[model samples]
Each structure stands twice: as C-alpha cells, then as structure tokens.
Target: MSLQSSNDGPLDFVKYQNVVDGKLVASSNGETYHNINPSTLETNPEVPLSASDDVDKAVIAAQKAAESWAKVPWDERKKRLMDFADALEAHTEAFSQMLVKGNGRPPLHQKIIYDKLI
Candidate 1:
C-alpha cells in the first residue's frame, strides 16, 4: 500500500517545504536537495535545506510551544498526549508506508513499533 495525500498525491511526491510556526515554507536561502530513494535509486522531492535563519525561527517557535505546553495542567497534558497517540494510531498504515520508503524498514516492523507506542 502507498501513502497517498489528497493534495500531494503520494506522500513521497516532490517539491516539499519546511514547516515553521504552523506553516509550510521555503528555506530562507531557497536551498534544497533531492532525496535519492534507496529502493529505486530515483530522485524524490526537493527537500528544503534549512538555513540558519530557519533554525532560529524553528527554535523560537519550539520554545514558544514548549512554554505554552509547560503551563498546561498535568491531566490536560496527559489527555492531549493520549489524543495525539490515538490520532497517530489511526494513521498507522500511512505512517508504515512512509517509514518503509524513507528508512527501508518493513511495514511489519513499523506496525510493531506503533503498536508498542499505543
């Protein structure tokens, strides 16, 4: 099975972007590198080569999220985490497909790890 995205068609499809502050964006310097798929030795998406400015932006965003998350009550945090885990579990097949292509891990192996997480 393949991981298909409504917009991107396939999860492995090309022309990717960097995500910062809850948005998909390009590198500050507009640099990218195509990931060579090991199975087919084919070029994949032009993944962003994040610049120092992007690193700074990402760090700042992460810090803000961490600060807000730290203030949440313990029970609320547990509920949110459990909900996130459930959402991940629901997408196990797509995730397994992605891992198989990206890391060359078998789908079964991916399933096992996801199961353990839940």
Candidate 2:
C-alpha cells in the first residue's frame, strides 16, 4: 500500500491496538499514561495502556497465528518475510530518527542503519 499522510496518521500511538485473542478492544479501564521526552522534558499525552488481560489475549492470538504460520509452505514464508524486510527498508530512515529521539542512542546508530543499506 502506498503511504498516505493524514492528520490522524502518526498521531495514533496504539497503531496495532494490541491485538488480543484475535480481537481488538480499547483498554478495559480506558486508562493511559504519559510518555515524557527526557531530553526536551516534553510530556506526550497518555496513550492507552494495555492491561494484563489484553496481553494474554494478544499472546493467544499470536500462538494461534504461529501454529499456522509455522506450517505454511517454506517458500511462501520466505517470500513474505522478504516483503516485510523490504517494507522495513522503506521506513528505515524514519525508524532510525525515531529511535535516536526516543532512546537517546548514539549518533552512530543511525550511521549503522545507513551502512546496512550498502
């Protein structure tokens, strides 16, 4: 899918929404917590927090997917994995920037990502 910019795009932190039990649901308590930026000391609004129950559901769904994913024809799995890798490459630049900003990692980490593209 071609990437399209929407006012709503990156604003949603819970992108996948913590898929649980093959079902998606908002936080049971509708709770959230702030994620502060350490460097700028900026506070981002509380994103929804996934409760333990949600985690269990996610695990069960993953387990179910893995069982089928594992049994998939090996060639098909390899092709799908390659597609995922390509998608990652497409976003590597943004990912590195986000990583540095979020983790305060050394500048070299970005260089490492660039080098990998070689």
Candidate 3:
C-alpha cells in the first residue's frame, strides 16, 4: 500500500485489502496489524484487522453474488473461470511476489501452485 504507518514515514508495502461487494475496504474500525515476513522478520505489509461486521458484510455480498452467478450459464461460468486462470498465468511473476509479500511463502511453494495452474 502507498500508506504511511502512524509513526513511520512511508511503508513500502503492496496494497492489500478486504474486497467486499466489488469494493476494497479496511477493517470496520480502520485498524491494521502487521504481517511479518518469516524469512526477514520484517513487517513489510500491514493488513486489516477485520471485525465481525466485516464478516457479516462479506457473507451478505457472497450471497448476493451467488444468486447472480447461479443464473449465469454453466458454459459462461466455465469460460470466465478459465479466463481468470489465464489472467493469473499471465501475471505469475507479479502474483508470486504478492503472495510472498502478503504471506511468507517460499518460492518453491509459489512455483508448485503456478505449475498446477498451468
């Protein structure tokens, strides 16, 4: 994220958020907790410390989305899922970095997942 911690100057973090109803959001209280990289022991990324309200919102959004998705044809859904996979494949490098930054995932772990995606 291009956000600065309260006491720190600037954070060199890749923005991460909770996506609800097609919108990105922070915790209900706007609170965040550090995600420390296991290898470096550095908190490069900070993530939302969601509340029960966030879970409720996400559940409601998922229900609404499921209702709409159920109406879509199976073939169209399949095509869209394939397209998503293709998009992920296209951004394997960047996505891998994000995974590593967001969680302390090893390169091999990412490689295995990418290989399965292929």
Candidate 1 per-residue C-alpha lDDT over 16-111 given as tens digits, one digit per residue, 9 for 90 to 100: 787777778899998887666576676665788998999999999989988988999999999878877776676677766665666666679868
Give me the candidate number with maximum TM-score.
3
**In candidate 3, which residue ranges exceed 4 Å CA deviation?**
1-13, 102-105
Name the Cα RMSD for model 3.
Answer: 7.3
Candidate 2 lDDT for residue 110: 69
Candidate 1: stretches off by over 4 Å: 1-15
Residue lDDT tens for model 2, 93-113:
666655555555665876596
Give lDDT for model 3.
0.75
lDDT of 3 by residue, 2-59 (tens): 1222345333336668888888899899988876777767776678989999999999
Instruction: Give the TM-scores of the predictions, in the order they appear.
Output: 0.76, 0.68, 0.79
> lDDT for model 2, on a 0 to 1 scale?
0.62
Clashes per model (N, Cα, C within 3 A): 0, 2, 3
lDDT order of candidates, top first: 3, 1, 2
Global CA lDDT of candidate 1, please?
0.73
What are the runs in model 2 whose C-alpha is more than 4 Å off? 1-16, 21-25, 106-108, 111-118
lDDT of residue 19 for candidate 3: 87
